[model samples]
Target: MPKMKSVFVCRSCGFESPKWNGRCPNCGEWNTFEEVDALPKSSSSAGKSSARVARSITPLKEVDLSEASEVRYHTGMEELDRVLGGGLVKGSLVLLGGEPGIGKSTLLLQICEHLGKEHTILYVSGEESARQIRLRAERLGVVGDGLYILAESDAQAIADTVSSNKPDIVIIDSIQTMGISEINSAPGSITQVRECTNLFMRLAKSEEIPFFIVGHVNKDGAIAGPKVMEHIVDAVLYFEGDRNLSYRILRAAKNRFGSTNEIGVFDMKDNGLEQVENPSQMLLSGRPTGVSGCCVLCTMEGTRPILAEVQALVTKSGQTSPRRVTTGFDFNRVWMILAVLEKRLGFCYSALDVYVNIIGGLKIQEPAADLPVAMALYSSLTDKPLGDDVIAFGELGLGGEIRSVSHVEQRIAEARRLGFKKCIVPRHAIKSTQKFAGIEVIGVSSLRQAFEAVK
Candidate 1:
């Protein structure tokens, strides 16, 4: 028998060290190192030996492309399908991570409801019992003979079951709870997560079965596991939203089969999560009319355009350094906008406390949101109400010039559909903005011009 050796691994990046350290040398994260048993070198040597076996190899040109684009499984949920770039590809591995009680399990069970109708699914839960899953499934109206549930946590047992049963789709309720018995490490540890994910990845590829693995998020909001686990999977998706709110946003952090810019929205209810096909309308509903520091903007998420509200509040300062707080928007970017407003627009915001927020729990990262944020700040400072039936979107430069943004026509069309009477855009987009009807489009080249248009 080989003597077991121990090693310390960083929970954040999977960087291995012979001994424990207060900080990870690789990822620069402090106190993330945990001790775990290291796999014997003989085991890896055996794996390499098996890899040397003679196998038939085909040239790239010899491979057939007939089934390349034809093989896609639609999940029956249009929102999910769009995020997956049409549909789920055969033999692909998808990792879904979210905070606890954020509906990760509910979403997977919901998918099984539609996928189970046409394809056999092996549902494996490491944390929940079969009866518990059944109870939830019954509530979600998931009834199908093709769905099979297993409550085992042993990684080897799962691989054996997949090989023998050969289901079309495999759903792992979570990767953290599953572990290899031979590894001598607790479940959710870095070593166990990396090894278990590797096992599932190999099984999914060799057997050509699609896999959906659920992962947990850490305190810092990143997936709680070795970073290598993300690289091993074909895709990484994050389910994000305020737990108190009913709306949920599913965004891809990485995808081999699709674009990461795409996002899927769902409204959580007692029945389950229902897809929001028109998120623009859902977000804009019940918006206050004739309000200061409120402006609407259109942002493109992949091919879909979404309208979101930007709001700001500027009040007299009570302290020497006025507070600058922002929610669902970048703080540094907001500060830059304030600097431009002070230097270029001649706004004296240095002595005021500024607060900015993006409505509906939506996070805006695009530069196109700059102009609207600036406008909202100006409106709040001057105590002038920007009309409810107006929309604005443009990138603001340091020189106070409004820069052109992509997909101007799409943004205008979405604003028009939402009953907005006027649109404010960059001057360079006037040519494309002319085709949009029923909405008054105003082209402006600078902040002065934008304020004049709104007046």
Candidate 2:
């Protein structure tokens, strides 16, 4: 018999070290090393696997793809479908991650009502018991004859049951609580998560069963597991928004079968998650009128155009150093914008405090927001409100020039649909040559010209 040895692994990057350290030498994350015992493999199960082994290689053109014609299972939610490219692909393993109490389980269970209509579903929960799942389903009015629930944590046992039963779809309430007995480390460890995900991935591909697994996030809002676990899955979806707030944004970080840029909006209710079809209207619901430091920004999310309000506040500083606070916007980007305003436009911001926010909790990552951000800062500094029916979308360069943005025609159509009278865009974006009847398109080449035209 061989003596077992314990090794320390970095939870962030899955880097194995003989000893523990405060900071991971691989990923540079502090206090993330965890002790894991290395158990010897059983000799009796040597070279045995439930996964199908390929007997021979075939040409790519010779492979049959007729079965893939109708391989998608729609969850009956348009917003979710849009984010997933079209629908859930067969033999695909999707990882859904979110903060605790952020409706991760609720969204999975809510989709079963529609999927159960034509497919058999096997839902496995490691956190909650069968009775608790039943209680939640009853409250949500999710009654399906083909829905099956299991309250087990053993990954090997669940895999065996799923292989024998071979349900159409499977849902793991969470991957953290699941563990195989072969590993000596406790459940949710780095080793367990990686190995368990491998097992599920193999099972899904070999059996052609789609899997939806819930994952818990860490304090940094990243999925709480080895980074390899995320790379192993076919798709990775993250839930973003405040839990106290009603609206939740579902964004995909990785998707082998779909576009990663797509997003789905949902309104969390007492029953379950209700899809927000027209997110533009939902975001502009409680907009204030005749207010300085406020501007409308039209940003593109995948194929959809969303209107987000950019708000800024410029006030006199009382402390030795001026404060620059921002929410739902990048802190460093805000500083760069302020610097451009001071350098290019000759605005004195050395003794003034600046604050910026995006309404409805939507974070704007696109450069098209630059024009609106600069406009909001100018409005706040001058204490003058622009026209309520005005909107803008153009990237601002370091030289204070308005840069052309993609999808100018789509942005103009959305602004016109929203009843905006004037649309400020980059001069180069005017090359689209598509004239909108109702909306006035104002093209500007420089920052000074944009402000002058707006005034």
Candidate 3:
């Protein structure tokens, strides 16, 4: 028998250290070191594994690529399928994370209803009892003979059940509660999460089973557990939306099989998550007919063009320093736009409390939103209303020039489909050879021209 030694690990980066420190030397994160027991290595098992392993490696060209045609399992949710790069690939490990009460469990359970009809699913819940799962399943109207529920938290026991049952797909309600008995640390610790995920990864790869692991988010909105946990998975999907709002957006933070730019939008309802097929129409619904400080912008999400409303409020400041508040839009970008407006267009903003918001809780990350933001700010400051029939999308430079944006034709087409009569784009965006119908495209060379055209 050997005595176990205590070691500290950084919760952020999974860096192991023999002693504790204020900051991790590997990742430079402070107050993240958690002390855990380090078990002695089993040399007998290690030797056995090494002895059974093959020393020869096959050449890359000699490997057969026929296995790439393995069929994917569709969740029956088009939005989810889009974010997952068409559908869930076989033998892939996906980590779905979100804040509490953000519908992480609801989404998974809902998918089982569709997947259970065609494939066997092993849904292991560590957080809730079997009865609780059944109640929720009944509430969601999910019924299937192929959906197997096991309310267990022991990792080794779950693995044994998986090996015996051999389901086509598996869903771990969450990874935090499951723990291996061999490890002395409590469940959800860094060691438990890492080891448990490693076990599931091996199970998925070796057995050709697709695994969906539900993960909880930390205070920083990152997937809970060490950062290495995210690196171990094939894909990472984050569910994001305000609790007060009925809509939830599913985004892929990392994907090995598909594009990370794609997003899935769902309207959370009492029944379940209802997919928004035409997100543009849903976002633009209930928009004020004619309003100042509001402007619609065409932004691209992956290959899909989306229309978002940029709203700004400019008012005289009553305090010593005028406030700058923004939601769903970059704060620094708002400041830069104000500075550019003041420096180039001679708009006095030093004493104005400027507030900017993106309607529908959609965060505009692209630089192409600059022109709409500027136009919205100008409209608000001047108390001039830009009619709802106009759409704007272009990038603005410090020199006040509108920079050309990509997919201008696509944006214009989307605007037209949404019944917008006019579009304000960059001068260079519209080439002499290009043409569009059903909407008037006004090309602007600078911010001044854009403001004049909008008014």
Candidate 4:
């Protein structure tokens, strides 16, 4: 028998200390430290011995490639497929995270309708009863004959079932509720989430079956568990949108098999989640026409180009320090843009309350959005409205120069498809870009030139 060893772990970040502390040094969360076992000596040594026996090293060139081709499983959603780098790869572990009622489980259940045609799916739920899942599935019209439901929380039991049955696909309602009897920590605790995810990861790889695990986000909008849990998964997709709104955006934060920049848009309907194929059109819908402080910009979300409306309001400030507010845009970048506007372009915004917003819930972190935001501010400040058909995208420099952005051709094509008559781009990018027929492309080197061309 091995002596018991204990440690204090931060529930928020899984930071372990030999003793307890009021505040977690790593995550800065107070009163999060809880006593937990360091590890069972018997289990630790047993795991090490098993790992040594299981080790099989092969030359990189000798690795088999035959099973790697055309093994993707289409989820019956084009937007989701696009975000997933074509389709879900076999034997991959994908973690989908979002706020409560943000449609994480709904997305998985809806996909089963398509995947269940040829593949058997084991849908495991620890948080909800089988009847509750059935009720939701019925509402979503997911009446697949091959979809099996298991309402269990024991991780080892689920692994045993998967190993014996070898289902084509597995869906865990959430990792938070799943736990192993071996571990004394309660379910949803950092240790349980981390260990449970690891169990599923190994099971998915060894069994060659794909997995979709749900994760609940904390108030900080990050997945509730140790950060290691996210690292163990093959892909981490976050569903972003206001619950009060009908739209949701699934963006991949990490993807080992695909690009992380991809995003999937879905519209929440009475039935279930419906994929939005043309996210540009969906975002640009209900856009105001010929409005001052409003302009359209084309941004590339992974390989897809999306056109979003940027609006800014410049008003006289009542307070000593004028407010510089932004929604869906970076605060520090706004300050830099304002500084450039005042210093280089001779536009005084120091005493004005500047408010900038992106029309859709979609956030614009790309520097390509800088030009449009600046243009919107100028339009509101000068009380002049640019042409409704005009679209702008370019990075701004402190020296008052417009910097060229990547995916120039794709952005222009999306704008042209959206029926924009005029396009504004960096002057340097025009040298290599071909002129389009229907739209007038204006290349401006400076903010003044951009404003003059639009005027």
Candidate 5:
């Protein structure tokens, strides 16, 4: 028997230390170190020996330079496929991280069901049983003979199963839940996560197997694992949205093979995760007519443009220092916009409690949303509603000047498709577009011009 050692690990960043400390030096997080038993060297050595025997390496120049036809396995969900840059590529490792109950498992199972026909998919769940997965599959109406489920957490066993079955794709329900028998650290610990991820990475690269791993989000909403987990994977995707809403947005934060900024839209249904074909249309549904505090904005999510509603409400505050509350939009940004309105437009909202919300549970992070947010606030303050057919989007400067936004053409096209008859855009955008059919484009250089045109 080999001797067992112990180490201290940071919970926040997965930084490891040989001894305990009050502060984590790597991440600067206080009191995050937790002690865990370390794996015996002999056990890890045995695994390494197996890996070396299983894998063969060749020189870069010695490899054939033939141009092999690219193969894509569709996940049966168009939205997911689009986000993955068409479909899953061979020998790729994708990491999907999100909060609990964010439908990570559901989405992957749905993908398996969709791809089970043409591809042999191995669905390994460390946290759930085969019967539990079958029940969910039944609920999703996805009964396929090609989809195989294994409820196991040991990494060695999983590796053996993958080698024997030769699956086209493999999905680990979660990497954190997987415990390597060779590693003495508990499952979800830093050492275990690092070891398991390394194994999966080697498997994907050596076997030319495309694999997906479901990751959990920490309290700070970041992927819960060692930083190396992200570095080891080919792509890192985040599934984010309010649990209260039916819609969820999947965005690629890091991609080695494709664009990182791409996004995919999905709606959580009772049956399973359903891809939202036209997100703009679904977001604009149930929009109130003739609302004073409402304005339309076109915001870009990755390469796609989505038209969303921005709503603001201003009322007298009973407390000292009027409260500023914002949903889906940054609160500090709202304050900055209010200050700009007071200085440039001569509107004082200091005595009012302002509340802002981006409709449809969509978060607006782009500065282009500033124009519509300001318009909505102004409309509420003055009790005047803008035309229902009007759509506005542009970045607002502190001096009241309108700033140009990226991908203006896509925004305009989305507005046109959604039947928005009038558009208020930056002056710079107007110079670029010669003409757009069936829509009136109003270009403004400053906030005053925008207010006048809408009024």
Candidate 6:
């Protein structure tokens, strides 16, 4: 037997040292070093040799393209399928990272349940036992023979199971919890995460099998582990949303086979994750009948248009400096609008505390939401309510001018579908032959013109 040595490793950047220090020299993060025992050189060598033997590589151009049609597998979830560019392609490795209890496991389990009827799926969980997973499946009302579960964390054992089963799809509950015996570091450590991800990548490519690995997010909302882990995967999807809200968003940050701008929306339910086909209806529900601080806005997510409610509150401030707060909307952008309101509209908002919020917990990132945000603030200050049948959205400039927004046609169509009788948009957005039967489109180039038309 060889003697084991101890070393200190930094959790942030995976920097290793023989002695501990107060600050990590590599990542500059304090109190992130931990001691771990090092494995013998012989064991490490054996593991590397085994991995190479299990996986094979070939030139991309030399490989036959005749079997391309058989490489794709449909998971039966339309939203998910869209995000994945139609379906899962064989020999592709996908990484799904999110905050705790963000439904990473639930979404993957649902996919397995739906695809298990036609194809075999092996689900490996390093953090939970078979009985625990069974209970969860029962609660989710999932039952299928083609879906198999394994509750082990050993990398070698998992590889062996994959080789024997040769299933159509494999899902690892999380990659951080799995450990390689050849690595001296504990599970969830940088060394272990890197090695396990490499092994999975090898298995996916060599076996020509599609694999999904769930990942944990750090306190800063970033994917846990070294940055290299993200580079190794073919696709990286971020599952994000406020835990207090039932809605969750799955966005593709990186994709080798599809567009990165695509997103999928799901509502958390007692049974499982339910796809939200018409998100506009849910977002516009429970809107106040006649509110001074409310406005409707059409925003584009990817290629789809959604109608969302914008709310604002303005009141005289007692403090020396008025406070400005915003949720689900940009803070700096709100400040910019305040400046415009004070200068262009001749409004005295400097003495008032302003707050803004987007209804249904949806975050607005596009400039198309700018007009509604400004109108909501103005309506609150003036105590004037906007009409229920009117919808407004456009970008605001420093000169108090309205700018054209992308996908204007889709926005108008969505508003028309929701029974909105009037729409205030940029002049450049209106087409020549574009006319709705019952709805009217008002085009404006300046903020003053928009306010006069809406009033």
What tens-digit string does per-residue lDDT give for candidate 5 at 1-455? 55567788776766779989887799786777777666455434435555535566999888875546556677888787777887887889899988889999999988877689888899999989999999999998888658999999998899889988899999999888888896767888766776788788888877989999988876641234535377668888889988998989998877876787678999999998888879989998999999899999999888889999999999999988998999999999999999999999899998999999999888889999999999999999998998899999999999999999999878999999999999999998767547889899999999989999988
Please, what are the lDDT tens digits per residue for candidate 1 over residues 1-455? 66678888787777889999998899888888887667555433325556656899999998778977447888888888878777888999999888778999999899888898899999999989999999998998888568999999999999999999999999998898998998867888777887888888888888999899998876551334636477778988889999999999998888999899889999999989999999999998888888899999888888888999989999999999999999988999999999998998789998999999999999988888998999999999998988998899999999999999999888998999989999999989777436667999998999889998888
Which 10 consecutive positions of candidate 3 have the poorest summed lDDT?
39-48
Clashing pairs for model 3 are: none
**What are the lDDT scores of the predictions, listed in order?**
0.87, 0.87, 0.88, 0.87, 0.86, 0.84
Arrange candidates by lDDT, highest first: which order? 3, 4, 1, 2, 5, 6
Q: Return the candidate ranking by TM-score, descending.
A: 1, 4, 2, 3, 5, 6
Q: Indicate the TM-score of model 1.
A: 0.92
TM-score of each: 0.92, 0.91, 0.90, 0.92, 0.88, 0.86
**Model 6 C-alpha lDDT per residue in residues 57-78, reported as the tens digit of each score:** 8999977878664477888788
Estimate the lDDT of model 6.
0.84
Q: Quote the positional error of residue 136 for candidate 1 in Å.
A: 0.6
Residue-level lDDT tens digits of model 4 in 406-442: 9998899899988999999999987756668888899
Measured by TM-score, how close is model 2 to the native structure? 0.91
Question: Would you give me the overall lDDT of model 4?
Answer: 0.87
Clash number for each model: 0, 0, 0, 0, 0, 0
Q: Which pairs clash (backbone N, Cα, C closer than 3 Å) in model 5?
A: none
**Model 1 pairs whose backbones collide:** none
Worst 10 residues of 2 by lDDT: 38-47
Show model 3 residue runs off by greater than 4 Å.
1-32, 36-69, 220-228
lDDT of 5 at 97: 85
